[model samples]
Target chain A: MSDDLIGADGRKLTFDANQIRDLLPHRWPMLFVDRAYDVIPGKSGYGIKNVTVSEPYFAGHYPDQSIMPGVLIVEAMAQLTAVVYASAWKEEVADSDEVDTAGRVGYLGAIRQMKFNRLVVPGDQLILKAELGKAFGTLTPVTVQASVGNELVAKGSLTVTERGSGGGNGLQ
Target chain B: MSQSYDELLDQAQARASLNLRVKVLLVDSLGLEIQAELIGDDQPLFGRGLELDSLDTLEIVVMFEEHLSVTISDDDRAAFGSVNKLVDFVVAALGEIPRVEALA
Candidate 1:
């Protein structure tokens, strides 16, 4: 909600858990989306997740200390990509002949070349960004990078499939 | 269905306490940042208020895996929408392991 949120392109984006909940149906113990910023729907989006010690994984992780896992980093990135496409093309889907399918069907089709540059830990905030990668009919791929400050944490690519009226199987 | 939400919350909170304690032990035992309100129990760990962003999220994810050895599914990783929702989900997820194993 700041003037600066809009990059030079002027397309603005944002989301909260309530919004994410409506978009996706992963309940407690799942649903890894928090808030999104500067999302351009079909083109790109930025997602944010606040890391904390109050996570279940920490109890069994170390008992004494907790560190974030690498796999989750990439998962977070994928979730952000879904948000991007939803924001980008939701309206078009709604207006098209398949509005019903558009309601709950953004799928991450694939992920590639995942590399974690650094370790993630408690109290660290993760910012995931996605941009257009490649497109082929219903499937679109994206380039994603996660970072803290100037340091890169992870980088990879993800592909997503859109849903029209009949395709109601939303991803978790 | 599982033990209970309250039970899970307690479990997550206890671990969270340990993490904070460690943060204090390693970085700020003196509570210096306390004066500036650098971090708080309810402050937003990422974005404008605390300005955490991506790396922080990854750090938490790493911490969970390193300490718990439980992999957060793409479905459940670094989630924070409402403090209540986050704590609830984490506790439930952590507690579900016993049940999952019992089923096996």
Candidate 2:
């Protein structure tokens, strides 16, 4: 078995918005990760979410002060997780005749020890990161962090069900 | 050196309390509807017994790490078979069943 945590072949994987759309089930207002890079397949990756003034939530989240909701930051981290796992699945099926790794979504199993450091406002570029841990059956624990520039926005660990596990409780 | 009756009784009490704590964490962390006291020591944690799916396994793993300071890796998953099995793993890892009062 290969002992490398980061696969050499998958390290070069990157995703733009259109490529991310092909991998994730999220769309429109729900899609948080605008771009992804430094991907090591199922191991770890980084993503970017360009927080803009035109975001729908800013209309009411406080018309006066537009701070990005902390939950959305968590959701963005989850989406980046999907990219990591989905990209890994794609690598597994690369040589196969039927390569259908599109729209594979991972369900959030549990979020733990999340801490929001500072407020995320409009015109901020949210940098998201996730690193995979040992799997507990189909549940894989991911350590995630979201930041704007050099300032940390949120940091935590969360568990997500593996892709195609079908562990969804009819929420899909 | 042989052992006193009181010492043995205290150890037994600690083990019993540990079993209940494991059960309580399983229920609380997994968001199970049943009460902890209702769970039998020998009852299976997955499948037909507790009906816990794969998603709940990670919560139990984290619970052990955060509360008991025991790291249950995938290789040690046999500990997840039952409540008693989990407590036994913890006791084995810790080298003793720490008394509830002592833990406090």
Candidate 3:
């Protein structure tokens, strides 16, 4: 709630996990975004996911070596897109409480030109970014990229279908 | 008479080359199992023809932007009906590539 976290447009630029929970329906284990900042409403946004050894996937993904899965990295980027779109929706419906913007869901329709350049490991803070591309009817395409510090991890374009009244809360 | 015939032949070759390029783009980029030459110009690209889905269409959109330097909007979905239609769409979007450059 710091003034620094608010953009000049009066939109929240940073969101903690508790605030993210209100915009996204994802619970523990599935929710990949830990903290999001530099959010520009629906246009673009940035997020962070701190990969750690305590993650359940690391338990069996290789006890000796823990490499964060590439798909999960992409998922993190998608979640950031969700936050961007949901935040935009919340602004549009600020006066209405009957419509729950938090429940708005976006389903992954297609992943195009995805490439993984590096392996993400435990202790790495995955930085996720998404830019809204074009809207093809209900499907909104987003250009996404993820990196750990300066090392690029994954890049792709994902088309998410906005379902339900506010956009569904599941990835299909 | 022979001069006009040669011009017609040149036009035919240019069209054929454009069609071949479109087919190759679709097969190579989408990893379609069929041979590029086998994809008929008039054959449907979706459903019963090449069985292309929405994802394939999106990939094709990217392909058009990257390779052909042409942008295909959502309104242009009908242009993706077949190899011939796609060639026409690309040609139109590109404002007619010279016959020599197209064949080359």
lDDT on C-alpha atoms for all candidate structures? 0.59, 0.82, 0.81
- Misplaced by over 4 Å in model 1 are A1-10, A93-103, A168-172, B1-104
Tell me the tens digit of each residue's lDDT in model 1 across B24-80. 421232223443223454555456544543323333343345444434344554454
Query: Residue A89's C-alpha lDDT in candidate 2?
Result: 82
Task: Write candidate 2's Cα lDDT for B1-104 as tens digits.
Answer: 67899988888888888888887778777788998889999999888999986667777887888899988987887988999899889999989885554322
What residue runs in model 2 are displaced by over 4 Å at the alpha carbon?
A1-12, A163-172, B1-40, B43-54, B65-78, B89-102
Report chain A TM-scores, every model: 0.79, 0.87, 0.89
Error of 3 at A28 (Å): 0.5
Per-candidate clash tally: 33, 0, 3
Which regions of candidate 3 are displaced past 4 Å? A1-3, A8-12, A101-104, A164-172, B1-11, B97-104
DockQ of structure 3: 0.28
Best by lDDT: 2
Best by DockQ: 2
- Give a tens-digit lDDT track for model 3, residues B2-22: 568888887788878878877
Error of 1 at A87 (Å): 1.5
Per-model TM values vs. the true structure: 0.53, 0.73, 0.82
Candidate order by TM-score, decreasing, is: 3, 2, 1
